[model samples]
Target: MPMPASYPTYVPRKQFTQYLDDYVSHFKISPRYHRSVESANYDEGTRKWYVKVRNVSSDEIEEYHGRFLVVATGETTDAFIPEVEGLNSFTGEVLHTTQVQIGKGI
Candidate 1:
C-alpha cells in the first residue's frame, strides 16, 4: 500500500545523548568492563581486525580481534568541518571544538 507523503521522518541524533542511549539499548549486549579504543589494524590472513584499547585510569593497553568493526564512538570523539571559500587564506582566529579552552571570556 502507498503511504502518505506527509508522514514525518524520524531523523535520529537531533538530541545526541538520547539517540545514543536508544541505539545502545536496541542492542541488548553487555560487556564486562569499559575501555577506550586507541587504534585498529586489519589482518588480511584471518580477515579480521586487531583493535587496541586503553584502560583510562591505569593507562594499560588491551587488544581485541574481531571481523566486524563498528565505530560507536559518539560526537565527542570526532568533528566535521566544512571547507569554506576563504578559510585557508584567512589567518585571523579559528578554533575547533576539539581544542581546549584555556582562559576566561575572550
Candidate 2:
C-alpha cells in the first residue's frame, strides 16, 4: 500500500502495517500489490467479475476474477470521516444509507 508515511499517536506506522498484514493474511485476502486496475467487467453467464490489471513495475496487463469487488480507489477528498468521540461504543455498525447508491456504472 504505497501510502506515504503517516504517524498516529496511538500506533506507530510499522506496527499498524503489521496489524494490517496479519488481518489480510487471516482473511485470505491476497491483494494485488503494485498493480493498477484499468477496468472491470462482469460476466453475466458466470456471474463473476473480471478486471484488467496492469503491473506497475512491468506494465503487463492481466485479467483477474472474483464474485464480488470492493472498489476502494484511494483518494477520498469528498468522503468525510467525522470525529465523534463516543461513537465507537454505540453500535455494531453504522451506515449512512443516504450516501449509498446501487446500480451499474454508478
Candidate 3:
C-alpha cells in the first residue's frame, strides 16, 4: 500500500520563541553580545534610526544612529515576569534571559 506524501513531513516552528533557550545559544555570536535597545526613533530626513542602547557593563547609556535598524529585540523583553509567592525570597536559582544572556538567548 502506498502512503500519502505528507505522512512523514516535518514543519519547524515559524516563531523562534518555540525553541529552547540553550539551543538558540549555540548560534549566537560572541563579539557582539546583547545590549538592550531602550528606545528607538527614526529620522526620515536622514533615513537613520536613533537608538538608545544601554551598556550592560558599567550601567551606562549611549545612542547610535544607523541607516537600517533590524529591531532584533525579541518578544522576550516585551513581557513582564510574574511575581509568585516566595519568588523574592527564593535563593536557589532564578534568572531572566535579559539578566543572564543579555537578551540574545531566546
Q: What is the TM-score of each candidate against the true structure?
A: 0.42, 0.53, 0.38
2 or 3, which is superior by lDDT? Answer: 2
Superposed by TM-score, candidate 3 places the C-alpha of residue 79 at a distance from the truth, in angstroms, of 18
As for TM-score, the candidate ahead, 1 or 2, is 2
Full candidate order by TM-score, most accurate first: 2, 1, 3
On lDDT, who's better, 1 or 2? Answer: 2
lDDT of 1 by residue, 1-106 (tens): 1122343454344444454455557666455356887886666678776889998777899888876654443555566455554547644454554563322212
Best by lDDT: 2
- How would you encode candidate 2's per-residue C-alpha lDDT over 1-106 as one tens digit per residue? 3222463546676877776776677669777788898887666688777889999999999888987655564555466545444446533244442365322122
Global Cα lDDT for candidate 2: 0.63
Report the Cα lDDT for residue 93, model 1.
50
Clashing pairs in 1: none
The true-versus-predicted C-alpha distance at residue 14 of model 3, in Å, is 21
What's the true lDDT of residue 67 in model 2? 73
**What lDDT score goes with residue 65 in model 2?**
92
Ranking by lDDT: 2, 1, 3
lDDT scores of the candidates, listed in order: 0.57, 0.63, 0.54
- After superposition of all CA atoms, the RMSD between model 2 and the true structure is 12.7
In candidate 3, residue 27 scores what lDDT?
Answer: 53
